[model samples]
Target: MLLDLINIRKVRRAIVYFGLILAALFFQNTILAKVPILGVTAMVIPCFVVAAAFFEGGVWGCVFGLVLGIFYDLSLAGTSLLFTILLPIIGFASGSLVMFFLNRRPLSFFLVSAAALIITAFCQMFALLVFSQTKVLPLLITGALQVLWTLPLSFTAYYSCRKISGLDLSK
Candidate 1:
């Protein structure tokens, strides 16, 4: 009886996460991309991963990060499998922070989300600089703009995941 209940909760959690992923993908690709801030579009996927990890733990974070990373890789043209590689690490680290030290709160979410975004932006900047011979200043500017633009939405992702995590699956 207990096992059955646990399994049911797992299923419900997965379904909720799937729905969030779909919504995030739609928002990121369609609406968010269309409205550029400083000519840079927001990459909101990392924030989602960070928030999920913040609430859900490292394993769940890593799993969803991989899933979201695939979507991210496919959505952007001419990019290597960067997010696929980076997001899982980001998720795992974020989750580990929660497991080891941090509490689950919006402030924690904000800090983790910002760190994740900055790391991703740095990785992206490094890739552009090394591979394409892009100028450092432009790459830095774009990456900074993207991080700044996306940071505000971390609250949304945080609250969404927080609400989902707080659900009473047994009921």
Candidate 2:
């Protein structure tokens, strides 16, 4: 009976997380993308992944990352497997780092989220930089702008997941 209850709690939690990802996906593609800061959209997905992974642990982070990536890939154009490959790694790394090294705090989230955002922005710009003649200065500026724009909003993910983590599953 206790095992079944634990499984049910986990399933419910998974469902909630899945819904959160889908909602974020909708917000990202529809509302967030349209609002450009310095001609660059805020990539909120990384914030979601990093926050969840940080709060949930490595396995949950990986699973959410994979799901988010698959949907993200399907949503975007000309970027086939980019996020499908990257977010999971970021999620797993973020989760593992939190599990072993970092404490659950806002400062830690900021630092880790910033690092993840930097890597994501670099990978995105690298593809364009390599394939085309986009200048380094412009790409760097845009990436920095994106990170700045997205970082503030990342608190939403942090607080939300923190609340989720606080839930009493033992009940």
Candidate 3:
């Protein structure tokens, strides 16, 4: 039955998404965290979510994003739920925007990834500035640095998600 097939597909997708999230978490904490550059680890997380949105549907992107967000938030010293809330919204928006006005192209993927990074970094910097005595200039500079690091990684993430999702959003 169609319903049975749908359910099975959902289960398979869940498994794949879970695996990706777990790997991301493990690598983020153990390896990527040690990278000489700060914020690189943080930026990579949302790239995966954005890639999911590009290759799969909004539903898939949102679910993976939510899970990644929760893990990302919990890892931080602060209990900020910004990642938990924002990535899913970004995923959903990415999928919806692509569906409405873009083809599945490198440019499209870049734009979506850039938008995700911008929004996430902006919210994070703004939150830091507002809630603490952090200087705006430093926050902005850090965000820019993170974005620079994330750009190439976004392409990798996009291709990786396309492979993992197996959804071909071009349809």
* Predicted model with the maximum lDDT: 2
Ranking of candidates on TM-score, top first: 2, 1, 3
Clashing pairs in 2: none
How far is 103's C-alpha from truth in model 3 (Å)?
1.5
Instruction: Indicate the residue-level lDDT of 75 in model 1.
Output: 81
Task: Report the candidate with higher lDDT, 2 versus 3.
Answer: 2
Best by TM-score: 2
Report the Cα lDDT for residue 28, model 3.
Answer: 65
lDDT of 2 at 147: 93
C-alpha lDDT of all candidate models, in order: 0.88, 0.90, 0.80
Q: Give lDDT tens digits, candidate 3, residues 1-171.
A: 777657886788788878888877776677767774754444678888878877776887888899999998999897798989999998888877777788778888888788788888899888779889798888888888888777877776777787886666566
- For candidate 1, write residues 1-171 as lDDT tens digits: 777657887888999998998888998998998998768898888999998898789999999899999888988898689989999999999999999999786777888898999999999888669988998998888988998999987788888998899943345
Candidate 2 C-alpha lDDT tens digits along 1-171 = 778557887898999999999888997999999999668889889889998998899889988999999999999887579899999999999999999999878899999999999999999998789999799999999999999999998888888888887834235
Q: What's the ranking of the predictions by lDDT, best on top?
A: 2, 1, 3
Ranking 1 against 2 by lDDT, winner: 2
Clashes in predicted model 2: 0
